[model samples]
Target: MKMVDTMCNMHLHNYKDILEIRRNTSDFMWCSRELNLTKSYRQYHDLTDPYKFQYDVFRSTDIQRLIEEVSKCNNCSNEEVSKHVVEILKEIGHTRQMAVFRCFGLCFIKVLKEVISCVFVNEAQILKLKSEMGGNPVIFVPSHRSYADFLLMSYITFHYNIEIPCIAAGMDFQSMRVIGKILRDCSAFFMRRSFVDDQLYRSVFKKYVQHLVTYGDAPIEFFIEGTRSRSAKALVPKFGLLNMLVEPFFNGDVPDIYFVPVSFSYECVLEESLFAYEMLGIPKPKESTSGLIKALKIMDEKYGNVHATFSEPISFRKYLTQTLSATLDFTKRDSVEESGHCFHLAYQIVDCQQKNMVLNTFNILAMVLTNHLMVNSLEPLLIDHVSKDVVWLSAVLKTQGAVVQPISHGTAVSVLMESIKVHQSLIRVSASGTISLVKLNNDKCKTLDPQTLRGHKLSTDMMNLAVPMLTLQLYVNPCLHFLINSAIITVIMQQVGANSHINKNSLFMKFVFVRELFAHEFVFYRPVETQEFEDALTKLELLSIIESEPLRLGNHQKLQALFCNLLYPFFSGYLSVCRFLLTADNLEWEERQFLKSAQERIEEELISGWLLQPYCLSLDMISSCIAALTSMIVLSKIRRGSQVHYKVDKDRLIPVISHLESLFYLPQKYQTRDQDSLEDTESIQVISSSEPLQRLVSKL
Candidate 1:
């Protein structure tokens, strides 16, 4: 395997490169019973007393002052407000006990070994980060991909003798009966999904977070993405918790606050099936102890390796002085804080997270298969073609600075076969030696109720095809960040004519428009657009895919097709919204009603052969399109009581739709077939691989 740069901190480069020196263990050893069971008891443990911590946070001057201030504002007695604050603290606080921590560590290890082959972490970098943990508070902002993410970090810290961070968890887990109390004992603090209207709760939560930051004994951990990304893409960072985190540094409570962006990449997530169903308009099952027991059946299966990378630690103090140039005035007590500064800093952490993401073989292989299925839907992919395309795509991603795992020399097919074996629940190879996606059981959702769906209800026919296809696309979504910019250029040039010349100015204009159009769908560091654009051009030039001087096209036809086809579904999904808006020029619909209308309209288009991509059946993308349109002012939003309604401004929408339509065109071969293929969902089923490497399936 080829090694990539694992360290992101410049100062840490002076240390000996340990990541390069450490040899990767075999998959068998990664899942070994002894490895998972072993523990180092002699390590220093600086665990905080949860009871004292809570009392400290409650009695802190910040919380007391805020409580008094809120009581005065509400014209209430201080005692009443104090009682309310105490109740709020109990709801949100964590209770960390060393006994529970050690006991849970063992249980988590057993659970983890059952499902995952390995958890690959850079020890040297983690030790370096641990050394820098003193004198100020630290925040570990890891990307959220799975429920397992919450457990992994705490386990790692315990193994490495570092203090376990007090994690911010959603209230969904807080109601999971005994499991909730256990998690709290393991240092997981619960917070509501949204407390925007509850001033007392919001103030208490902020003060609780600020107290955690100010104490400087234990690290505070939270998902900068705020929630698990169903699509597995880096979400636009949430500002509520982030604003609270940095407030201390702005007010001189801490000299510096360190923000570490940790990226977790899974070969396959435990929630793959659930996320797939949820994306196809089915509501996610609520978190509960009963549900937890039901999910234990998945422990019999094997999810491949996971890579957790700790990127460079960002100092708020340094960033304020260097990046923002003291744009935030700390002296002005009455000055309002602009969200733009927070946004810049948040995106910076997200960018680091993306950069440090470790792409497994399955990620690249899935993308190759998705690209193939776009052109030849009925055909199975040959092993040779799969191997070649995997190599080609891996090279493409590496050139763009993506951290793709290297294909072993001359063993690409075997490596890919192993990946397919690990993810056999998702894809399969036949006795004929050709690979295809495994069809989701059509009868699985027969008992599903329509009214319970979180989004528009779809027919069983759509669900059969949409579920597995979207699941396949979920693996492909992580690679989108590396491909989106260049792919946009490819589509633009394809519109102008593949071999035609276009000025840089004209290409950039189209690029900016499309970027803004999908702003809600993907993460784009808005402050650095010019630099991102220039970097995309440079990457394309380095790959010999395009020319820089006067902006001419290159001869890399296969690479161009890869880019074009990879992003085609997204454009198709977004275009459907534009076409829908064109028809409903003056019509107004409530926000939920608008989304349902758009989804139903798109389904009709897909079935009637007007739209081709089945992957475009994403409710997330449909909602993201509406959000983008509203932000762009192509659709005007108005409030009526508790409901929000949208009206399309045809004048502004026409040009936008025209531009979208200009960039989008589907060839006949790539389009969907007639409605006859939709008669029975069973016809979509394909045979599983011969013998299917079931050795890994039944027993690791």
Candidate 2:
């Protein structure tokens, strides 16, 4: 087996548009009577039938062993639990029928061609991965961005002659009428969104996932994030599937397992508008056949390009010995060490996904526009000015380790114009050559019934900017992975005046506080406070904004301002949550009630001009703030039946609220000293790092 280093370096120029070759193939041979329909195809020779794999799972020794253990725990007869296990295997299993797969592929190909301009992939990476196949189970862990992720992997593997992976899909898709069975036949296995209450089902799922890893020939694909990131950012990974996938290797059932990290970048996301509505208080529409049919309207529009990059396959055995085994004992399955192993592995995959991401030109444009809006929301951006900013920002991001779409594709002006044409709905260039946001009608938001609202109902005034601003934020999100560290440092510097020389130890504590405060807003590898601080300092130095030895801000005011603007909206939202908690007359409130009222409070602040960013009126941010506060023990939850209520700990929260307030009140120009307020850091809640880290990890 071939092994690539743990940190795989992805070259932006290496990817080729796989669709280019597909479009050149003879239509007759590509569609009907293709290689997939032929008996001598690679899949036929190299892979076991998925139905046979399911049959083996149903009767596997692992399932039988689990049944015995579950029966003993539940005080049920072996026969009863055995019957339940069998029923579960039937429900959770997938069958890959070639005929149905080929039929769907044919139709999907046409849709892809009509809607998307190109599908870029690193053919060399796929070929390298193909060589690493067959000795052990291969787990394909992709970052989920859109529903298109499910189909993109299979499409690429089939085109490359690799066996299509049996995907772990949500049960929501299982009810999509004709699409459900077709998806199953194309190798999709359904699982409920959650099964923590159903012990029998949980046991079955664990054993079933292990069965696939231990015995199935094809690769197994699942999302590390567990769901589509409506914010277009990476989410904290869930460990349930990672645990199950690695159990076989620990049990000695398989020699080893391979974990592959896959990333998908869309120039223009198909569900961009829907995701924007979801960011506000609008409820997501259910996945139904009607919804799927209605979504076909996207075919008439352009979704510029979709880039898929596969990182090096990580060797489970080697990773265990070289990384986790140092501190964890693989012998104890339920021990804290075992939990740490799962989390480290999950974080590694998510990190790799971010490392290999391909940033589109629009991602850069979005960031520039967002910052521009911060200075002047209503003014139209001139094409020449935006082009210059895009070029400068692209260079800045590249230096900070981002793989931006090469400017060699065209001049910055032409590239910017082309990207605007692709996203004409969200942003537009008028005949007079001024670019501005396309706003959603206020009447559209006014018609939503209160019960149908996902969270708080926004006032018509707030609703005017809600959709466009949120959607623009979504585009800006993909760039956060590169900018997050520097942004954090910038906010810290802004808090303490530019001339202040602070102790590195004291600075790191504040860094920890800010990082944890937004833990739910961003995805990060935990238990690495020291490493993250050093990296942020390194990145800040790389950007020439700070000197690392004594940690002093540089004289580059423009660059510092960019970093500050990038994170202002999120900090504004969190500050609003903290302020709401500080002033609430009631000490305790239900969780659901808190989210609505907090958002309402923010809406009022927006109207009164106390809030700086309109996009800060977000339920998601408010909910994340509540989670962060709860994890920190600044707020404690009380469970009443199915609903959970929170009680504020004013003592712990006052410091947090004061700390956030002081940062904003500092000189915005990053110059002058707030000597008295600098002393207030003595009161900011001191976190003994590890306890809060473990608490948050345990909650996840």
**TM-score of every candidate relative to the true structure:** 0.88, 0.90
List model 2 lDDT by residue over 197-308, tens digit each.
9877887888778877766777899998999998898988998888888878778778878898999999998998888778787889999999999989998899999999
lDDT of 1 by residue, 489-572 (tens): 877876776467899999999999999998989998666787778888888777656776668766554565567778778888
User: Clashes in each model (backbone N, CA, C under 3 Å)?
Assistant: 0, 0
In the predicted model 2, the residue pairs found to clash are none
Model 2 C-alpha lDDT versus the unseen true structure: 0.77
Clash pairs (backbone) in predicted model 1: none
Span of ten consecutive residues with least summed lDDT in model 1: 675-684
Q: For residue 103, what is the lDDT in candidate 1?
A: 65
Off by over 4 Å in 1: 1-47, 69-75, 326-339, 377-379, 667-700
> CA shift at 544, candidate 1, in angstroms?
2.7
